[model samples]
Target: MRKPRWWAELALIAVVYAAYSGGRILVKGGEASAVEHGLAILRFEEGLGIDAEHPLNRLFTSVPALGIPADFAYASLHYLVTPAILVWLFRRRPAHYRAARAWLMTATLLGLVGFTLFPTCPPRLLDAAHGFSDTMAHFSAYGWWGGEASAPRGLGGMTNQYAAMPSLHVGWALWCGVMLWRYGRTPLAKALGVAYPLVTALVVMGTANHYLLDAVAGVAVMGAGPLLAPYVLRLVDRLRETAEASPVVSAGCETSAGERIPGQRSVRTTADDKQEWGLPCSSEAESLGKAR
Candidate 1:
């Protein structure tokens, strides 16, 4: 595979992120429906006895130390660490970068679809009697986020508060974790690979920004990414190949003789083609002609 250029990769990421953000803003599900879906998820989790949001939220809020940092993490790390890891892969593990990047972009687009289809409210937005608190709201004064999700203080209105199902926060953390663990050579990197996702899951739950099911859905989304990424990569390759294979003249005249050569076409031979055909390259052909 050809090595990807940093600028091109950056532009691709920026465009994808802009699309994801714009999709989230546009799919603002109705408040009543969002809450109902949130309740449904809560009931489902409770039936399975995995309703961890309440307890986690209470623990985070009751202690400022835990609550403040968790809020910061919920608001910032989702934006920060993912890109940092992408840069790390580009610089340190170039061979693995393309596949990893494709996987992440595919998963992110999948997340946008989930957000569009299932815009469930977060645990924090449910009824107060549900026993879940919005730790981000509680600790808003300590950080840049406001009463609304993790958007900036006054800019909170710009974000879609109800797009909580299949939390991309957890999904991205899982992606980052996998990249680090798979490509990172050091023990610390592997250890971080395990710890990062677990911590992010806890942070999202503890902050009441996502339900346990949302985190599970996020994991499921990440799982689906790898399976779909190869196809995406292949499609991109085909498009690139098509663009590169522009039409060439089918026949051309020899300037010296001024005669047309039928069935002769102008084609650029790649190194692989020369190897496969066992043919001398242009330079070698020239050297042989001179020797003759």
Candidate 2:
């Protein structure tokens, strides 16, 4: 397969990211509804005896070293590591990059759909009685993020705080991990591939930015990506082929007999050119002339 152009790929990524960001901001559900959804999720987890957010949040907030780094990871690595892996794939694994990119984009769109459908308040945003702490808020002085959900200081208002149903942070990290593990031949790369997603899931929970179920939903979204990516890629390819195959009509073009034909170029043609242009051969032309 021919490698995609770098500039075109960059533009595509930028457009998709912009759409994703805008979708998040636009789909901020009402705070009351979001809180209710979050509580419902918490209750469901409790019923299953798998609610781990409280313990993780408590552990992280109580320890400075853990909280500080986990805060940093929650705020920064979601933006940095995913793209780094994308670039790595584009540069080193061209053959796999297209499918991987499609999968990532598909999963990201699905995450956005989840955000739109069920905007859940994160554990950090829950009441004090919930026993969860916002690690980013606690470590605000140490990093650029304000008390808000990983947004930079004073810029938190720009982000959708309630769009936290399926955590794309964990989903994207999973994507990056899979890419590294699948494509990176180095042992270190393989190790990072396994560790990155697991650590990110922990960090997000420890920071209270995502519930365990949110992380599970994120994984579910990524799982669906591979199954859907082939159809998405195939649709794109079909559209591209259709565009390329469409005839381009040159205005004022005419045949030798003064008959204007749509989509015919205005140029003299040789036998090979006639064949390429879908025009009649010399013998056919002569026969047509005699009949006329």
Candidate 3:
């Protein structure tokens, strides 16, 4: 494994994040369908006798002090913690960062596809008749959020409220936890790795930002991402190999002696180069040929 190109990697991450953000905003239609699906999901949970969001939200709101912190976690940590972990991994564990990043990106893309295909409204968006409380709305004053799920004041409309079926929040949190558990050296690190995702699951449910099934789907997505990573990485490797094999200069750029012309580009001479004009010897040309 070669050293990863930092600039290219950062640029790719930034571009992908922009695409995901823009994608959520662009796929903002079918509210009626989304509402119907959300209701159906709620009913399905009721049928299973595992519908916990209502009780959870009620418990959270019962303690105004706790609700404030939970709201802050739901609104902030979902975005902050994942990237912080990624940067840490990039700096400290470059060997593991590639696979971790690939898995996260894979799950995120799958979540986007879910949003496009099944835009189910979150519990917050459900009607009051359904016994759902907008916990964030109820506790918005204590935090920066303004009654909308994680969106700032007056900018709530920019976000797609219906993109809530498969919660990337839970998925990313779990991914972070998994990475930490597997790679972290200390016991406290491992404990926090397990704790963070569990806390995120509770936060998303308590804040009414996602369904129980949504969090389950998030885990399922993460599971699928690792399975798909091998194929995706192989494709990326093939593309990189193809690009490297292509010529970097014109066919006639170098003469039979394989020496650079004057004023084209400065060629640095190494210690062993004893040629009259500092030209590369036959052995050097052979090594360059093999490298190419």
Candidate 1 residue 276 C-alpha distance from true site, Å = 13
Question: How many clashing residue pairs, candidate 3?
Answer: 0
Off by over 4 Å in 3: 248-292
What is residue 164's positional error in candidate 2, in angstroms?
A: 1.2
Which candidate, 2 or 3, would have the higher lDDT against the true structure? Answer: 2
TM-score of 2: 0.90
User: Comparing candidate 2 with candidate 3, which one achieves the higher TM-score?
Assistant: 2
Q: Write the per-residue lDDT of candidate 3 for residues 1-292, one digit (tens) a residue.
A: 7777889888989999999999999998688999998999999999999889889888888888778889999888988999889888999999998988898998899999999999999988988888878888897777777977889988999899999979889999999999899989999999999999999999899888899999999999988999998788889999987776554432223443467555566344443443323433356554664576
Model 2: per-residue lDDT, tens digit, 1-292?
5679999999999999999999999998999999999999999999999988888988999999999999888888888999888898899989889999999999999999999999999999999898888888888999998899888888998999998879888899999989888888999999999999999999999999999999999999999999999999999999987775565433332334556575555454455554454443345444554575
Candidates, ranked, lDDT: 2, 1, 3
lDDT of each: 0.87, 0.87, 0.85
User: Candidate 2: what lDDT?
Assistant: 0.87
